[model samples]
Target: MKNRKPLVIGNLTARIPVIQGGMGVGISLSSLAGSVAACGGVGVISTAQIGWREADFCKNPLEANFRAMKKEILKARQISEGKGILGVNIMVATQHYKEYVKEAVKNGVDLIISGAGLPVDLPGLVQGSKTKIAPIISSLKSAKVLCKMWDRKYQTAPDLVVIEGPKAGGHLGFSREELETIDELGYDEVIRSVVKLVREYADKYKKKIPVAVAGGIFKSEDLDHALELGADGVQLGTRFVTTKECDASMEYKQSYLDARQEDVCIVQSPVGMPGRAIQNEFVQRVQREKLPIRRCHHCIVTCSPKEIPYCITDALVNAVEGNTKEGLLFCGANVWRCDRIETVAEIMEEFQ
Candidate 1:
């Protein structure tokens, strides 16, 4: 592993190849991101309803998000002290997806890791900036499609390709039926195939596209396994949740630390995708009744207040703020294994 070298995406480099996968609605903001970057890892902040904690977020959700994104990026850079990578995770399914990328690039972000949907046109948005693009893919088919689209349309390939497996948190790339058979699909086998699939494109385009694997990655052994399977790096999300620098409240952090293996399960998200989360009282309530969304934040174009269940924005914010009973506690499949809270530096040491 010592001979593997650091993660290099375009001009930016991370001393450690672990990217702290972005957790949103206030999780993994400046505090967490900055600490990870300063520790020589790529730090990512999720832009999903990023400004929910802001005072004026409800009235003008879009405007508030733009302002908060700028602030978080600058704060993370300051924390990094110009070391490692400062990146943002903006979902392609976001209502104003292009605007988020333009704003992040405008503020001189180091990287944009787009997922939750295919980001075929991401390159065009960051054309003039130093920011690099990495599209998250789950299967060999998606990987080939993304590479082909980018190559034909922009004459380019991804600077980095992130392979997210089924055991991931938040919204998943797989369908509900597929989530049930995660073990049958075999995560290790899937990663190896996708890595092999992308290598051809990397060689053909004459680019050293670093392939990173995300999902259920916990410690040093997990990191080794991903590398052993042919990935250049591993993206750590659930492990970061218990860190002191994590932006979520103490209760939120404790939830991960307190979770048991049985406590975690796949639940349906309002965005029409299945997600892994803690099976808490909040989750049970959502399943029992259709809690109406009183108002719309206009976050995702496909969402509506009058038609959907509860407002994901409200639920996630509640979770971030420590309202355990009513909060939507999104987590990875391995989150229940968390035993204690540690610093970002301490956790990064495991991978080192």
Candidate 2:
């Protein structure tokens, strides 16, 4: 009913309640994030291996990422021209997660949305800064647990809460078995439960904790459905991939455009998680046989160089750089629906 309402997280506000889901390894960076922010939506930069393009990335990954993170944030601010909200998505499973959070806070990022694990210490990390914090949750159980933990530990509540359903792209919160029977799982009910749970905490903490739903949200009806389900906003990743300002190479966007329903499948990530992605030569190869890890970028905390099937960072970089055959193409369940490349403004207009 209130689909046109702004998404307000503490003092930060976006003109539209649409938060562009952050994609990794160069997918959502300065260009994409800035463009989305400029269009009045909350634009998020994925800090996963964000420094891949830096000259000393391989030699010094963390330093490279830190340097690149600041640069990207600054560039995104310039592109946004003071419109909308700019946030960064940092996975709790990432190595040196605290450092990434500190760097983003140091740069005065408007918000930090974290997931892949419960970010219990997030509030403590941004204690003195004006940077708002939110956690990505899929179920009411996780929502209650995180809210309780953050409240007990730091006496603070999240500024925003994002519910990432099974249909989302990249590494998911649901298990492989759960994802297999996702349609039968009735995720909308879970969304409602989380919204109610967050409202309870919002009352206790005396602040608004807006809930946003992610996954399979592509059309106007989808946005309406989320708002009707009591969500304050929607976070979308797949639809943005085909946008003109997306940071990924043209070939990467083409993969989404060329995708058929059957072309999308779930794969096991080397980080010991199940992920949704486009089925390709590389995906098939990884499923059947183990690909040797040439070098470790020290990206994920759970990834073992000797045991993992493939280097996730390397695969993602390949895809983002246009080497589709050898790259991993992460996508959403509705990736097949993306038929054309549009501008960020055009995409934002649809939600408006």
Best of the candidates, lDDT: 2
Structural similarity to truth (TM-score) of each candidate: 0.97, 0.98
* lDDT by residue (tens digit), candidate 1, 233-283: 989799899988999999999999889999998888888888999999999
**Candidate 1 global TM-score:** 0.97
The alpha-carbon deviation from the true structure for residue 293 of candidate 1, after best TM-score superposition, in angstroms, is 1.6
316, model 2: CA deviation in Å? 0.3
lDDT of each: 0.89, 0.93
List pairs with backbone clashes in candidate 1. none
TM-score of 2: 0.98
Off by over 4 Å in 1: 1-4
Per-residue lDDT of candidate 2, residues 1-352 (tens digit): 3358888888888888899998998999999999999988999999999999999999999999999999999999999999999999999999999999999999989999999999999999999999999899988899989999998999989999999999999999999999988772478899988999899989998889999999888987888899999998999999999998999999999999999999999999999899999999999898889888778899999998999989999999999999999999999999999999899998888888
Query: Which residue pairs show collisions in model 2?
Result: none
Model 2 C-alpha lDDT versus the unseen true structure? 0.93
